[model samples]
Target: MRVFIVHAHHEPTSFNHAMTSEAVAVLTGAGHEVMVSDLYAMGFDPVSDRRNFVTVTDSEKLNQQSEEAYASAHQGYAPDLQAEMDKLAWCDILIFQFPIWWLGFPAILKGWVDRVFAVGRAYGGGRWFDSGVFAGKRAMCSMTVGGPAPVYTDSGVYGSIGSILHPIHRGIFGFTGFTVIEPFVVYDPKRLGDEERLACLARYSERLLVLDSAPTIENPNTADYEGFVLKSVQDKHRGLD
Candidate 1:
């Protein structure tokens, strides 16, 4: 598989960095082509604005989607953004590796998505959900969390981690047409012993080797919906609604 990892951690020595590094090594050793965008190391800009494009669709007013559509047709993305877009297009599998901040992805990674996943390029013109631009590709999040698993459970303070990540899984990955793999979460890595960390890394390596066959989160099929709602109770029961 052609894998692209977008890593978003400021500290080089952090566990998030270690996961990305390990993935590259493991995937490459197994004969997979790999590319990494180390956002922090690259000094990536997280803010989105006119800086995202080389051409202006409307200088009088800033309309992001309008500019993105124009840029998509003309190849007018700023060099940095275009580079990231190219990598995104080239990869069969996309991975976002970072530390979960608060209840979501790091600001840098979120910004990367804002600037990189643009209209016409990533999604637009009725191309979304299962019919999205990246429909055939796969995406997964690999994150290190500050809290333990128990704390993120249904009865815990944070509620279900699945619910917490619904926006990322359903809204971002699924909506963009990528098959969503269940996230790889490392809980409270700072409190883990060296042996435990090694074990976690080994598990991550195992997951990568079987990525092609990994179980994925279910996404709603456009056919199952009537406009935006489910066509029937049966479809909803099947989780497609």
Candidate 2:
């Protein structure tokens, strides 16, 4: 299977980078085609701008839908956006590697998403929403955390990591129509002994080798929500209808 591995950490020697490298080695050794996108190395610009918008004949008067449709039809994506879109199109599976910074992705990585997954490409457009570009694709996130696993557990300091990642797992990937997979996380890197780190490295390698074998989580977008009646009539028919 073709795989796209995106690494978001800036520090080359960071544990996150090491884990990414390990995953790449394992996947490549298994004869899987892997594409690596190191956000920092590429100096990717994450900010969205006016150029992203599709200008209708009279864009000023166009409603949001009209403007969006025009943008989608015109295909005015930036060169960087086009490049990432091409890579995304070529891959069957996507693996994201990053360190948890303040409980989320680093700025550069977030920028990669903001820039690459633009309107028409990731979302927005008439039929595109109903049939998202990423539909049927598989995605997983492998993250490193400075905090201990105990702290992220139910009885621990920070609720479950799964709960913390609901936005990304459900709101983002699910919203885009990709089948989300259980994330792989490494916790308490600062305190891990050499032996523990070695064990984690081995586990990471094993996980990468079997990544394609794991069944993808069903796309949440496939569920029928048309039966539920919203309290407000205007809001009732809104969203994925």
Best-matching candidate per lDDT: 1
| Candidate 2 per-residue C-alpha lDDT over 141-238 given as tens digits, one digit per residue, 9 for 90 to 100 | 89988888889988887788887877777766766767787889998776778898889989988778777666555544433322233424546556
lDDT of 1 by residue, 1-241 (tens): 9999999999988999889999999999999999999999999999999999999979999999999999999989999999999999999999989888989888999999999999988888877778888998999989899998999999999998788889888888888789999889999999989999999999999999988888899988656433655456668888875
Q: Name the lDDT of candidate 1.
A: 0.91
Clash count, candidate 1? 0
Report each candidate's C-alpha RMSD, comma-separated, in the order given: 4.5, 3.9
Q: How many backbone clashes does candidate 2 have?
A: 0
Assess each prediction's global lDDT (C-alpha) against the native.
Answer: 0.91, 0.74
**Best-fitting candidate, measured by TM-score?**
1
Residue pairs of candidate 2 with colliding backbone atoms: none
